[model samples]
Target: MTIPLKLHVGGMDCAACATKIENAMKRLPGVTDISVSYGQELLSVTLDEDRTSRAVIEGKIRALGYTPAGSDVARTPANDAQAATAPWWRSPRGRLVIGTAALLAVAYIVSHIEPSWATWAYVAATAIGLVPIGRRAIVAALSGTPFSIEMLMSVAALGAVAIGQAPEAALVIFLFSVGELLEGLASGRARAGIRALMDLVPRTARRLRGSEVETVPVEALQIGDVVLVRPGDRVPSDGDVIDGTSGVDEAPVTGESVAVLKEPGSTVYAGSIGIDGELQVKISRTTADNTIARIIHAVEEAQATKAPVARFIETFSQWYTPAAMAISLLVIVGPPLLFGADWFTWIYRGLAVLLIACPCALVISTPAAVASGLANGARRGLLMKGGAALETLSKVKTVAFDKTGTLTRGKPQITDIVCLAGDENDMLAMAAAVERGSSHPLGLAIVAEAERRGLDIPRAFGGSSVTPGKAVTARLKAGFVSVGSPRHAAGKSALTPDQADRVAALEQAGKTVVVVLQGAQALGMIALRDEPRPDARAGLEKLRSLGVRSVMLTGDNARTATSIGSLLGLDVRAELLPDAKLAAIAAYRAKGPIAMIGDGINDAPALAAASVGIAMGGGTDVALETADVALMKERIEGVAALISLSRATMSNIWQNIALALGLKAIFLVTTLVGSTPLWMAILADTGATVLVTANALRLLRYGNRRSD
Candidate 1:
């Protein structure tokens, strides 16, 4: 059987490392697929477990000078003792940083104090610093990627040493080590946010054992285990609040700042803090099955799916490195052969050009930012499918909304009742009797109102018949009664002009009016209205402020749709059938990219028809599957959060791209004109990579200001 495995592989420095590992693993028998991310230090592989073992895979990575960390790797007492007694120079990265700093200082002192021995001292310094950097370069060369940044830097530094510029060579290697240190540190910090999220889940949980409280590992906690969460304690797992009430601070998991009140039935997720009360929660999920764990899994998967721009860059980079190598070769041979320039001068200049054009910074720019963006969104309760959805959301100029479950709560209530014959209770009693058997939401609302008013709602004696999406009819004590939409009821029941005017007035006020009939005579009108979500107007206002135009698409009457739209300051397209909503999306797409927000099986087609479909309510399987992005939160504000998150992510990606290309361009031009030295060129390339990565990590701060 084929199973997936993920390992944290250390020592991946550039995109070339990922490529090298991927290429090596693809040749292994029974390996189905592989994905490696330098930013996350993650290696995910699908392999036939019966045919190959993870030990063999780790062995292959170990041969390439990378350490693999996973569950199967056991720690021994001897290894622990060695780790504790390890010296400052035990860590290759840390040793390189310290050695480079010491060597650079020595080189500077010797160059000024003793000119005669300065060259030898500088040579020693370069050698000391080049040990770690040059080894990786050689490994990369043996792995078939000889044009990586490490390789380019190695070539440039050695060429300087051969040309009697030992001080410059030492400085170049020193700066290159510094850049690697920075990149490693930045990547570590980026992964730390995700690690911190994992840390929020306590290692052990307090579980009930008859009369004893047993301290057990969270992994040992199973579904239906009752766990106690004390005041100011993090919930051990995702479960229901069964014994106590408190305010829960879900900010760490869901980005909500205020503490939400939890009762007997409230859901408490793992990593949420129970602020002021002790609670007993019945575990609903296992340790690995909690919401936070699922979020982490989703984020890791999201990072693997490349953005459109990242794919283009990846394709461009396939030839970008070799093209850079070719250009450097031409720069070396072309100048000396064609222009009669001095060999050593042109060769040194060519080496500088090679280092300047390495493309490491440009290639690393997008995914780091993309990973950070995905992490940011996940922390905020917004599950962006991947960078592709985020990229699409950034360009969305028009946002279309479904009225029923999106803008308003899907639950409707009977708010107004008019009787043409008997008292209001008699009309409601008759209507509720027929509607009680109907499964429609409006029907349920009428029945609930009758129950709320203490009316004697009777059961239907005879068999009831209902037209789908129209009306319900059943035999009552008085006569055969029909309760349904105005048009549907008008066909089966008699309507007076005065009663018809009342229905029209109610419909115009955004109330969904259904006629109640006894035999052929219309008894009264029942008007129901689904109230707009409390945050609907505010969320729409936020979207408008962000320059996203809002449009309301519904199958309701014009006056009702207009009333809702005007209240929310949105463009209204009333009386739209499912096909009309799809056409509306296409029409909007003609002008610009449009996103549809919906949460119904009927809305699935329109959701799929738009540029990006954001599924709200998360109730139906069809809406979840059809939409591009599914919102776990049911509020309209989640739409605004998504838009804001997308804009920030895309903006960060562009900034990184521009920074990378801009630095490379300037340094490339400088190297060509003999203004930029080998050390400075490598520094520029390394600095740009570090800058873009650090800038991308800024997205970890996104959505921190979200309020309750």
Candidate 2:
């Protein structure tokens, strides 16, 4: 049987370090799949349990000088807290740097008095730093990864010592260690954003049981239990309110700027804060499955799924490292042997080139930007599945939207009622009795209006059936009654010129007129219209400004589609079935990549067919699990905001790559000309790695303001 293992890894300061661990672990006997992400500090592996156990796999990782935090079988929150809260000076890496730096300081002070004593003093400092680095390099080589950044630093420092440049060797090790410290600090900022989300849920909740209210751990609360939230308290978990109306601030979870007025039956997420009224919220989700927890998990897991540019960089670095080493070997041998040039001078240059080829910044450039982009998007409620989705979304040229619930307010109320025959109440009761069982949006709208008027609808019909996209008819005691579209009414019943003209006027006015017929004689017409959302027009305008075309596809008539389309400045594609929508997605693909946004089950096929599928709802289960992108909050403007975010993330990644390679290229030229010293090469490499990391962090502030 195959079993999977997930462990939090430590000591991975660069993307090249992750590659070294992955290469060493894949050679284990039964390891089938392995992924190590330095940005996430995660090691995920799958293997056959019969051939290899968790201990054997973890031993391989340990042999590569990477620490694997205990597996799920023995892991605890305290273990993580201990590792995270521990001071930097207490760790082995920190002590080595401090000791090496202290020795280098003592040697510099002593060199002014006696140069002979300072020579060995610098050797002692270099030896102290080189011992641990050399041991790790040997262990990495034995584990099948001989070309790691550690191996490069170890060889470069040792070569500098051989040429009697002990001072330069000591300073090189100190600077390399300092660079690793800077990387750890920068990566922590990205992880801290995710930790802030996890901290939003209160550890304990106030659960209400009958007349008594008990305060217990959040994990102790189960589904169906009600909890009381007082003023200025964050919600314990995801649930629906049973009583009390409050102004809830959801900016932390959903990024809605203003406070939302949440009443009874309104859905509340786990991290939102409650103000004013005390709300009794019934728990609907478990502690581990809450909204904030899922977002954190998704963002961490997304780091392991590399984007195309990241994968390309990783592949390029594989050959780039060894090729640089080969060139360094040639430089040391060709100059001294052929021309009898000074051996010490050429060998020093060779070591400088090797240190310049560390590949730390080049390897980490893409993943750091991608991880920051994913974390930034989650903070604003745009949950992208992986880097692939984020990259693909940046290339979307057209956005296809579903009509109902997507571009408009999903709820449709009865706007106008016309009575052609009997009392409006009696006709409404007949229509409500026929439509109470059906789940169509129009039918539900009619039934809701009848119930609001306090009409008693009796179950006086049987053998009810729907005519596909047309009306619904049923067999009653007196005769058959139907409440369907005007087209369905025109086919079965004849209407006089005046009544027909009234229906035409309503249809032209963008009202979905459902004719109520009693035994083939028209009783009246009830006009229903699903109004456009308040932000719908502005969202399309934003998309237009970004050079993305907007179009709406619906099963409604062309007149209605055009009315709503004109209001929102969108092209209308109406009367499309589920299969027709799928075809429409394919047809749009001919022009350019498209993203299909929808909230209903029928939109799934079209979503899958598009370049990127964006599920739009109030974070319902169907929406969360439907597509590559899930919009938890129903903001039509969010679609444009996400597109802007994707473009910004890609731009950040390009800037990182240029900084990494551009610095390396400049130092490579100087090292070849003998103008740069050995220690300066290492300093340039360290500076480039730190600069790359800091640039990628800029994406975390994206979408926070309109100007951004």
Candidate 3:
């Protein structure tokens, strides 16, 4: 019976790391299935119940220079606590172990000694130095599968002993161990990126109870609980500020380097640091529901979903391993037994062939490429949820964009406020007072404008109501004050012939006019417009260059959408409602894979429906949650760059896979056809592994040309 277990692993930095962990685990005795993801810092292992223990699996990871946390086996409290901390590489012990292993390997490799002596020395040193750290590998190999990299290595070493060639056997084990150690270190580096993200969420929060501060675990924080946040402290949960004020540095959360000034009633997210001042925030979400938690969960889920290419390798390996073993047996015993010739020499040669046919290189090729691609993306602020998403992104043919925040900046400002009847001050004052009680973006703009002009806004009058796409109505001392869309007010006979012309002119300029009326008489109008992002045009062109069709979808009128679309050189402009946008995405997906880029609550449904959804970092929670990929920087150019990077990554992965498999196939054939020497087989296998690894690492240097 295969028992599945989830282990929180540390020191993985990329998809390659996940692959390395999986490969290492599969080499264990009872491991039936294994999956590791650097994006989530997790390892999923399926093992035979009677053969392997959780301790054995964990020990393997440690030997590979990774820290395994959260398993069914015994765990130290300190280790569990540290699991909630920063990147694994930041830990003193993990660093020390990696540093020591690396130094020893380098020193041993550089030493000028006889091949036989050097081999034994390296093997002995690595076993002594890394075995204690990587006990999981030994235990896993011993308990479950009778054949593994360790088994092959041990056999090869003992074969030399059996033939009085102890030095040769030792050297073989040593070089192989060094290769394993190097692979583990690379994996650790890749996993560290995900761990860094997880570390952002504070483990505890300071709750306020009637002026007394009480420290409580973040998980215990409930909605509506007041939490006191001091300067330089990380916000423990997402909430609204009910008291105090501060400038929050949201760099870690939004990837924005600047500190945003926040006041009373402003929303603050978990993982953001309080740059200055104190704040008493009323928690609006639980720890599990917080933004950081959701991000972590999404990343983890994505990592678990395997890529199509990876799945192929796993399926192929099932038959490949058994077939290779059988072939080795035939070459070793079949011919000599049937022909009545000496078996010892041929058997020894067959064992050498078996050692070289481990398929370690082929198994590792695709994953290393995936890890490298993911890591490169992270450095450029593109957060792909997993290997599956990363693979899908490279194949996107058409991309749909949500207008607000996706193309145009989500923030709409009051560009011009005109008062027709009453004085400018009085007109502005009345409009701001009525809008103050509303939460709409337009309302916020009005309030912000009033505050900018140093105008004091009175509380909302009694019986205030807001109508979407229309306006706000308030019962005031003068009479009924209606503030809304120009068309709505015009329909109510509030606009004069001249005022109507002015409205038309403003509409032509892509500005939204809010008409303010008192008792059916026009008072004034406020003009607002969503600012186009600076990089929108350039990004659209770049996407076009990449052979991706760019389409703009907006709820605004056709003229407005067209005007913006034309400016950005978009191929299609669809003035659509929220449902229409979702339908549009569906329509496009019917043709082929489509990527939807959006950053608003309205875009959430469409994002979820698209083949791949990309969210702007500063977008709404709904958009972020729905998006498959999140770009931390809110620049349109980043989107194009991400596409380019994804394609580059996919190409690299395929190349590595081809190279590894091609080499393995050729070597296997040569061994079967002739008397393949032990040294030659070892050299070819190790050399091919190194070549694939180096090729994958080239992805790290991607985009360097542009920088240069």
Candidate 4:
């Protein structure tokens, strides 16, 4: 069997580190695939276990001069605190800080006491400060990527020292180290946000064991265990309330600010905080399969998939570094050989060109913003799959929504009652009694309405049968009662003009008109309707504000669909079956990228067919699996928020790209003129990287405009 291995690789300071690891691992005979994520500090490899062992993989990683931590090595409080207080020399950042400080101290002392030895003092500082950077450069070169940023920095710093610019060279390495430290910290922070999601789950859970409460590790929690939750504590796992009642705050999982009331049978998720009451929850999911776990897993998986722009940038970077190297070689050899320029001066200029062409900032421009965007969306109850969906969402010109459960609450309610002959109350009571044993949605609506009106609903004399989306029938006291579609109610007899007119009026107003019949005689009619969500209009208006057109696709009849569409000012494609909905999505594609938002069950096909599939959180697991994005809040406004975040993220990515490329262009030109100093070139390169990273992190603050 091909087993997957996940390793937490240390000392990966940049994207080039990931590339180098991938290149080295691909040479192994049994390794079929290798993916290293600098943002996550994770290396995922697929290999035949029989052919290659974990020991072999770890050895290879060690040989490449990187520490390999196993997946089981979790970041606990003790370990985290220890890491925080570790010695400065132990970490790459600390080493750089110490090395730079020592070099500066040596330079100060030598310049004051033995001024003639100042050059040697700076040279010694360069050698010490450049160790970490030089090691990575050599590893990358040996791994077949000769034009990594480390390589460029190493060459530029060494060339400076060779030209008798030891002080400049030391300063360049110092600044470069500082930049690498900043990038590492930024990348760590981004991954930490994702890791913090796991932290939200309590490590210990109070399990109910034979009337006594025992504290146990969350990992030991099993399905069907009844866990006791007290006030102010996070629910330990995904479960249902078996006893007691309380208000559970599910913001960590659903992003809903308000705490939902949980009573017996109400579902609760892991990471929800209990407030004001105690409840015993029967675990439905194990600790590793909780909602929070799925979300964290989804977000990490999403980040692994590259966005279109990120892929383009990755491809561009491959050629970009080699092109920069070629340009640098030309600057060194071309100027002197072709124009009789001074060799030493031209060489210095060429090294400056190399420093300016590191491409660290450019290579990271898209993924950084993309990673932040995914995290931002995840925190806000929006689950966008990856950069591809995030980027696609921004370009979607049209959004198609499933009407039921998406635009409306999906719960049908009794709206009207018309009596042609029998008493209105009597007829409704009969209808409710006939549907009492039926599990159909409309039947449930009728039964609920009867109970609300205090009607006496008698038991059916025999078993009731239901035809989906049509009718329900049962044996009653008088004879037989069949509550169903208007056609079914008519049953070989035409409806009176008055009855027909009443049904037409009700249907025209978007109500589902059902006929109550006894044998061949039509008794009366009852109308039910699923009301539009309170925020539906406002959410659609937000879409319009963003210049995205909205359309409603529903399986409802034309009259009902039109009424709802007109009410919300949306373009309507009514009476669409699941296949028809998919077909509509196909037709919309001709106009532009179309986003299909649905309840994620009945709409799964359509969701998959659209450019971007958005699922409501309450949707089935299959629907969630098929969707590219999910709004856990089940709000139409989530569409607007998703688009807003995508646009902001794409905008942020472009800004970083422009900033990196713009600064590099200016410095490259200045370096060729011999006016740009080595420190300035190094500073520009490092500064651009820090600037772009800071800009990308701003996306973590994205907010929702409306509630679901």
Question: Could you tell me the lDDT of residue 28 within candidate 1?
Answer: 75
Q: After superposition, how far is residue 173 of candidate 1 from its true place, in Å?
A: 1.3
Checking candidate 1 for backbone clashes, the offending pairs are none
lDDT of 1 by residue, 1-708 (tens): 898887777767666668878877777788876888775567888989788888888887876657786633322223323433445355566677788889889888987898888999999998878776677677656656666677777777888889888888888887877787677667666666566677778878899877789999888999999998888888988999888889998877766667889989988888999889988899998877787776666666677788999898888987888898889989889988998999888888888888888787888788888888877776666766678888889899999999988898879877778887878898889888887767788888888888988999877887678877677888888888888778876675478677778888888888888888787777788888888889899999888888889999999888778888888889999999878788888999999889999884668888889988888743233433457776755667888888887888889888988998898888888888889888788867789989998899898887666542
In model 1, the worst 10-residue window by lDDT is: 72-81
Clashes of each: 0, 0, 24, 0
TM-score of 4: 0.90
Clashing pairs in 2: none
Report the lDDT tens digits of candidate 4 across residue range 205-254: 99999989999999899999999999999999899999988998888877
Q: Between the candidate structures 3 and 4, which one is better when assessed by lDDT? A: 4
Question: Given candidate 1, what's the lDDT at residue 189?
Answer: 64
Name the TM-score of candidate 2. Answer: 0.87
User: Model-by-model lDDT, in order?
Assistant: 0.79, 0.84, 0.71, 0.83
Show where candidate 2 strays beyond 4 Å.
1-3, 30-32, 46-63, 73-83, 337-340, 414-502, 514-526
From the highest lDDT down, the ranking of the candidates is 2, 4, 1, 3
RMSD of each: 5.5, 4.5, 7.1, 3.6
